[model samples]
Target: MLKTVRSVSIADYAKSGVLILPLLSSRKRKAEERRGKTVRKKGQERLLQGNEAIVEGALRAGCRFFAGYPITPATEISELLSVRLPKVDGTFIQMEDEIASLGAVIGASLAGVKSMTATSGPGFSLMQENLGFACIAEVPCVVVNVMRGGPSTGLPTSPSQSDVMQARWGTHGDHPMIVLCPSTIRECYDLTIKAFNLSEKYRNPVILLVDEVIAHMREKIILDGDKPIDIFTRVKPTVPPEWYIPYEDTPTGIPAMADFGEGYRYHVTGLTHDTRGFPTSRPDEVDAFIRRLFRKISQNFTDMQMGEVFQTEDAEVAVIAYGCVARSAKRAVIDARERGIRAGLLKLNTIWPFMRTQVEKILHTSGCVIVPEMNMGQISREVKRVNKGTAKVFTINKVDGTIITPQEILGKIREVC
Candidate 1:
């Protein structure tokens, strides 16, 4: 029996008296295939730019407010926020400069918003005063410093890892700091969320030290759905608004923020203050307040140490690096391994409050270490300090307002080997 299976358009069958079609058109089949691709199943892949993914991460992290000034290397962050924030029912404001940018972020955080600002080297320098304010007032916010070369107004278009120390000590005296560095586009997405969580958790500024190279590089990043991200909001005050002392510390360093329209009355100052938030002239009170701010970070040191180890389990030589510099070191490690050398990398994603214990263990076990940075031996000192004269530590430094290429690192590794 050779009876043909007929396919007919329902509309044509309904409107006309003829049995019209035997098969669907290629155009119709192609449309169906296109629709199927768009209907995402349990798992699908995506390619994202480093900056675009950061914007997506910020929105997912409950960051409702952003204020920033335009600066090269990090301007994409602000541009992305401008378009994305409005769609998410959030607010984005462009301030006159980086100083005002951080000032607005602190103010917004105080008004019960998850806030952020982004800048490059020069703007980062300008934001220091307000950064100190956020530290003193215990305001939760994120600052992205897409680093460029510089002492003052240096290379704005190029990449550099020169801001590593600045992220920790830039703001000034006795204030707690947390800085995260990302080596890949995927990490750029993931760490932004983590930065927000740390800021809100500890009631301090969390810096994402991105470099110009990573900020501009495009890559394939899988946005995973199976693993849900853990997001943390600041601990709210248990006491009523009338009884709430804004600067009062709970088990956590953070204090619950009462919106200005609310009836709660509290003061905030860059000057040393008390639980009531009023400025204090007493030296002991100032000392105690500063100590509390720093202790909040030091006490929870375990939570902040983040790094990646590749082939380090049984390696004789280890390369230590962060930011884009780690990218070169990674390839160098691969080359060294192929040549019958036991080489590995300790890639740091968290730069500040240097992971001393982690570095110490590697240094004690490993025969030698190589530190590659875009600046002149900033992190090498920290590595040597942790090594404590146990390991032969070598440094490969570059400060020509450019990235250290993989070949350069390989040459150094060969020389040392």
Candidate 2:
């Protein structure tokens, strides 16, 4: 015998205060069986931990080389890829340390392989110099930072969003990179794919930021079986090998990348370089090179920005959040709506490039914007900067290795409303 409930109410579930296991109907059971087959055959639906999903997503995105050091809250990604990459004829190397891990990934990417490395806060900090090198050299690779507490190995197993600012500016010098934050297991998978795509498309490093909560949480995800994921490979140089200039300017501010041993031999160094890839001390050449790197990302801001809006069409109070904290803000928004508060949520999927246009619009239209982060006001500072006195910006932050609850966000909404 099988049974099904049409829907479950949050109120009822809260009143019960215990986990309820659902009974599936016969039709639902058969559908689930079909999904299981689809998952096995086409690799669509499955219960995946966030870190595991990232590995699958990277492989699907054509990540043929992985070089990473073991770091908690992210080591599982390297562990899984170590076994899986060989089966796909890809290469995986466990480097001696995070610096070596990113260094190896940068080398792999320049050799024309789509590559990645994963780490947590401490390891992420260790990779900064190499990360900057990859950026200045315009090598495409993905970096996954499953954030745990830190300024110095604060908490390993616990979740934190303390690395939000670091992801944007950990590396020294002026450079451009993309950083995406995922709040759910599904986004953990999908954004990993997106991170690689952006890195390839833009010829720069891309950071996928997830906290311990999302990285360790397991969830059922229904991957699309009918449609295949779109993967983007870096644009190869069209010039003849004799005339090929690795850093030649293009309309998109992205140069056509030439792979090593691909009939093109070009120099790559961290120094400011010219079109021919030689270190340039010339003021004009250095200025142009730096601007081009910044322009590639700044000019294509529309393409880089990704976010979600809920109940904001007529909201007077908006909640701006990202990472696992966004999950609580979403629930708080829903509860606020039920209580007749015109509240809404602006969930940032792409944290860097900072959704300025969207944030500006919210600042102008809404009476107040609430920012709740797991860190001590990292993103809230950005929100306030964009607000510029147009609207009130309230911050509710926590960094005690604990997640902010829905009730806490709701309370802030109530206060502001």
Candidate 3:
């Protein structure tokens, strides 16, 4: 006997606290079948590219503007947005390069439209200047980097975790940034949506860390309209239009954004600014503005540390990984369990803000932590910093353009354990 999934109404989502929508409706009796089922009302479940998934997620998140240059493994995002944006009454533009792409996205975001841009490592390198500009200006937008090998076009078609550090501090100077790395294909679809929400809520740019392997790998993602997705619009000030100070916060660290045509004559600039959004050369004003910008993100660390734990309870060894490496680490944990190694996996959906407290809790119960990344060990250093000498932090780093396999991670675990 085949059991069918019950389709629920949109209002029912809030009432039951569980959203039952059609993803890919499966005929099988397995728990992991959600990714394979396609609910027709929401969207059909077919083979979707990672870049396309990002495009869909952005659109669903109320992103009305997209600007980007076509780059390897991430071109599909721009290609899809070019056709989809106009149909949805949104705007899409192909810029001269990644720098212009980010410039356009920031301008549109300032105009009260949720905007996004997609690129790979080389393009990402060029966009850093404008990324810094968006940070200083407190612009809300999403940037998806389908990461390939780095260090000046190291490997275009290959997957690499080389940009993990770049996503955090590449823009230079003192700034707080939110970076989310998706391990699963489903997360590619889901986290892209969340990226926009966080960007809008915090009034900062959110980077979607997509590696090349996950970006190109075709996955059967179940699209369901019934899923209760949080779409956060930019915070609007309750103060009167004339009385509104754009840079002033409302206790929640987020300053209300005034769009370009909103009649709120606020000025925004790359240089240090003040409460009225005007540039100031005063030392106190510059100091206050920079600190507030960092606090807007650092203060929300509680909301930003999104992660998944696999068999962490009573584990002696833990595997910490993110992005495509997480998928491999999951299998390694299972294999280690069968061998009586008591290995666990901490898969990070939020890579930035480092989640040091949560990691400390895990380290208190574990003997060793293994960090497997596709680069020359970026996150392992963070793991070490968080571990604080409580546990031995070992790293398995590979930058040969291929994903770190489960066997590779298992070998590292064996050596460390």
Among all candidates shown, the one with the greatest TM-score: 2
Ranking by TM-score: 2, 3, 1
lDDT per model vs. reference: 0.81, 0.86, 0.82
Count of steric clashes across candidates, in order: 0, 0, 6
Inter-residue clash pairs, candidate 3: 23-37, 23-39, 24-37, 24-38, 25-37, 25-38
Report the C-alpha lDDT of model 3 over 227-337, residue by residue, as the tens digit. 666788987777778999888845666788878887888889887788888878999888878888888788788877788777788679988888888878877877787
Error of 2 at 401 (Å): 0.6
lDDT of 2 at 88: 90
Least accurate 10 contiguous residues by lDDT in model 3: 1-10
Residue 71 lDDT (model 2): 86
Give lDDT tens digits, candidate 2, residues 385-407: 87779999999989889999999
Q: Model 2 scores what on Cα lDDT?
A: 0.86
By TM-score, how accurate is candidate 2? 0.91
Q: How well does candidate 1 match the true structure in TM-score terms?
A: 0.87
Tell me the alpha-carbon RMSD of every candidate.
12.6, 5.6, 6.9
